[model samples]
Target: MSDFFLNIVEDEPQALSPEKVWKVAVIDDEESVHQATKLALANTHIMGRKLEFLNAYSAKDGLALLSAHSDIAVVLLDVVMETPEAGLGLAKAIRHDLRNFHTQIILRTGQPGYAPEESVITDYEVNDYKTKSELTRTKLFSAVYTAVRAYQNLTSLAAGREGLRKIIDSASTLFQERSIAKFSEGALEQINALFNINSDGIFCVSSAPKNPSPELAQYLTQHKHVDLSEVDNDFRVIATSTGYRDLFGVPLQQIPKKEVRQLINRALTTKSHVIEDHHIALYLDTPSTWQACIYLHSQQDITDKVDHEILKVFASNIALGLENTKFLTQLADTAYKDDVTSCYNRNGLMERAIPEVIDSNDHAVLYLLDIDYFHEITEALGFEYGNRVLNSFADKLKDAFPSDAMIARMHSDVFAVIVPGHGQPPIKRLIEHCSNQPLILENGDALRLGVTIGLSIHQEGTQADTTPESLIRHAEVALNKSKEQRRGSATTYDESLDAGSLERLNLLSELRRALSSNELELYVQPQVDISQQCKVVGMEVLLRWHHPILGNISPGVFVPLAERSGLAYELDLYVLRHSCSLVRQHPDLPPVSINLSAMSLDRGELLDDFASIMERFHITTKQISLEVTEGCLIKGNSALTNLQRLSDAGWDIHLDDFGSGYSSLNYLLRLPISTVKIDRLFILELKKTQHAATLLTGIIGIILNIGKRVVVEGIETQDQNDFVANAGAEVVQGFLHYRPVPFLSFVDEYKSH
Candidate 1:
């Protein structure tokens, strides 16, 4: 059944012109009617064209044939096919369901009484109504002739309206296109639709000014023009349609066809339209003094004078679009290009070059290069000379790399490049060559520059999956490694090098979960006053996290991670609020010291947030001592203000890790600190050497003399404890007294003690 429907003849095999064959579907259940219809149309001619019959045995087959051939001009439908009203049903489906109003339907019936002619014509939009007896050869021919003519006119008008719509839509879109390559391609597409031809063509623009005209002055006010002074005079093809797509960016002289080249040259030289046999070239003079030409190939001749005029108008619009696109291109260049070196900037590298390299099929390598000791060089030489050196170095990089390579200035001293893989050898040689010749400044000063290069290769299959950002990150990791080894060195990234980064990321994710899930616990270690027979003075609050999978993570490991990830502020607040709540719950416990991160003091709101938490827990400020590192005090006036605000609120701000950092005594006087805790390193070394003991003793005396209490940490053995206690340390905290315990256990132990 399918084969029978597939073999339905919609065109005459022997017809000289298939376009002249009016496609007519003869739908009926009777095989005899099909044969009779074919025989009647065999010698028939309508509107000086032959009739092509399509056979359908039933209404189902008729609808299938109509679905297969959208170009069918007329349907000679039989009313009594497969059912009583099958023919009427198919006619309604074609007009209503398919929305195909163009194809003319003529209902023919053997039984005249089955369907009334007038009602069927009005309801189903049927073109003609006839009984088989009345549909004689001449009558049938007449009916088909009228229907085919109507279909032809309707299709022609639809085509014209669609063409005009495409032109208007294309013009609006072309004005918004910023890329020259994309704009030129879209212009070719619009031109093809405007001409109603699938012809091959090329869109080319003169690299420089052609015949400069005064008419271009009017357009300059409305559009930007490219500077032609730096451009060459050759005409380059920017876009091509279909068969000529490979000719894009090629010179006009490279075109193989002499006739086409001559047409383009003639159009460009005259600054007008050139029409020839089976070809046409329209030239547009842009405001930038550049000539834009579109050469089209079509077998159909341009006989209509109106069409030629429309083509001229289209050429003018294309010229304006090209001018607009040129302005957009200039703006993009300014945004993406570095002003100092004309290389791609960080924005360009990430937005344009990196994506292109990653999306390309070929394997590529990314090289991240940093000028070693660039800050020192900039300090030695003035900034003006430094900029000159950068520009000269950029020129050398451009010279070393291929045209396809993407080079960008990622930072003040760091440059990145993406090139084809296996480029390390050439890259190494280029660096060596650059080092041999020092960059000469404007004042004839020669400055030698050293660079460290890191390489990351992206191949089809590698264990370390590469994205645009990951590739650059991996290369930067390797670059740091190179800088650590020596100047003027190169290193390649390996999976092992990135393992730590991956682990850090995972740890950050887990730490966030731990905070939310109550996996983090507060442990307290008692601070004992050594001068009063080891009396418990206060307790230090410490944070501890036990992962469900990794068991336990040390504060030393995750604390720095939290600080770097900007999570330290939240962590410190959690510790502060939780420790205060514990003290509020147990009024008998001694004062507890809560350590705060340096980052917490960066914002002014810290003091307010701390006071709010203290009020919420009903804990007094003096009951909770705030301990911050010595480094926090040197962070600027903001930290000082936060500390002063806390101290003025009657909170004791103890300087933790006092001697760990520079230990600038100026901080002791400047900051509102009431006590100092000696760093563990100093306490551990107290009994090891006499110099350590003397240093500890002197630091303790200075704290006491300054009217501040002293707490020394990490006292394990009796000798070490005795050494610090005799050294005038008021309080000592270490395993020698007690280890950090859970809040409940610490409370129980404190009560017993």
Candidate 2:
């Protein structure tokens, strides 16, 4: 044996558990064999566990012994016993019948002829094969020690696999929690499952505590229970299996347990993990608002019982996950909370109220309040003053509604409230307060408010439409309906309000298809110069849609649809494309005026794109006239910028829809416009009212004084035509002279003339 144990020095024995022993079974036909095996292995030790031998002389006795003691680590068997294959039969029984796969079976033969075949060692559940003559003292010792050590390694591998499975399951549960409080509550249970430690745990956090009381915190922890008051303070026991949930507004050193405090402090100082004796203190890198620690009080020796490397990796992963979760939480606050008003924004309101409203199907009332003429207010005052007004408005709403009401700033100039329960909300009181009382600003300015409210009551049957977004929309529709009758009024949602919305949806879909198809046509209305004996001064191009199934669809129906559905830009491009094509065909036509929307004026192919299309059609600026409304005169707006570009390119600009918009006299002189068309509203007013001419005379004179031609529209009567003719408006356009004709038909008639 090469003197393997001649100078072996044994160290002091470990404080191991009594059950930690390597069990061995000695089975043979002879009594001398059992005595020899026992003497050889009596002093043997492997992996801190000494060999324990159980003896059975015959194969029958060995079978019984092996079956009874399943944990026996190794079996020494004689191949030739009372029967020729008796020892082999016992090996098969230990493997199949007893299902003792972990036990190592070593076969021995006294005679060379009795030695088992190589197949018996390879496939008959035998770990080793040896002859009795070769079984010296050293060989026997080496064999027993090696087999016991192999058994120990197999058990360790199985334990490690189980631990890894537990970690996977625990990590899955931990990763799903988004809030810090929720994550902390789950950590104890998950970690216990991960490490297989039967223990009580405490999760402490110092993050964002409210109304802290250090005295109460100390008393509660000492008493083994805490009320909600103690839980509201700092250094709180956020989660615990059994004991006080204290909250202390002090340092982490104020933790009640001395050993836990030491471990937590050590971990923080080293910026690493700390494990000791029967307790483990895991310091987590939480948000800047809080420092946290999970302290486990385990009864079993945990430090050396679990895998150290696996714990370190999971700890690192857990820290990374917490940091990520806190980051997302901050981002969520930014996304869902309004910065200017400190109210829940649209998304926040939806997330908070929708699910509850759906689940309860409770008697809930929704209120949408719009600040009437709010745009004009913002325009008159600066944007800074607008913010102050909004903040003051939000404060008044909070005062007006109940404390339990869920309120939010839905959008600019629009506020919402969701009141649950069957009580009548004090909405009338809120309106009167907003209207009669003056909102006092920060700089001691008192501004009178005009509030318009729309309400929707949701109950059991209406749960389908009780979604936050839908209810808010219904409330807004009612608010607009109220505004149509009066600026400051309240209205409740009705089923009739939905008819127009449904129609708009159907038309919007069809309009999208019309833009690409041949269903759209352009018509030109003649603007005649009165002084020149009704000579056509210019032609204004208007769009008309011809739906295949619906037959003539009016521009009034689809024009607003185009604007609302973001198809105005494309429709404007369609007009410009066809207008340039017309002037290309009929070169002798009067300057064709095509009305452009505010959106189209800014974003349409007016600058570079207009030039390119006109260049392609071989048309000049003199042949095309763009009609703009008062919206184009917003000084520094994109529409004005595009208008300046068109004027710079020598294209004639005409102010259309003049009296309908912000009809400022300043725009008449400041803008690069050559002609102005009075809206049809003034013409109808002139025929309906007594003093309408006075208004029309002054408006026409202003355009005339600016050296800009005035076109009086909707002059269907002879009296109306002569009235404008004498008023020196210069040009007049209406169905009385010529209804809008197709551009091609007008061109054909002009060519015939």
- Report the C-alpha lDDT of model 2 over 1-753, residue by residue, as the tens digit: 110000000121235575678888889988899898888777766656777888888899998898788788888998888988888888888777888777888889887856666666555658777888867775676667556644553343443456555654454466456565666666677777777778887776644322324643453344334453443234556567654355323346576668667776676556566777887778655323235567777878898765776665445445444544544455456566777897888877787665565466567888889897676566668778999999999988888877777778989899988877765556677789888899998898898889998987777765347667778888888887777667788998987877866787888989988887857999999888888878887899999988889999999888877876788878887898898987887788888888878767767466888788889899898888888888757523556768878898998988888879788887876778888889988888986777888888888887888788788889899888888877877788999888999988988877786
Model 2 CA lDDT for position 718: 88
Task: Give each model's clash number.
Answer: 0, 1
Candidate 1 lDDT score relative to the true structure: 0.77
CA lDDT, every model vs. true structure? 0.77, 0.73
TM-scores of the models, in the order given? 0.59, 0.65
Query: Model 1: number of clashes?
Result: 0
Cα distance off (Å), candidate 2, residue 566: 2.8
Q: What does candidate 1's lDDT look like per residue over 162-242, in tens digits?
A: 434455445445544568888888787777777776667899987645444344433332233645354444789998888
TM-score winner:
2
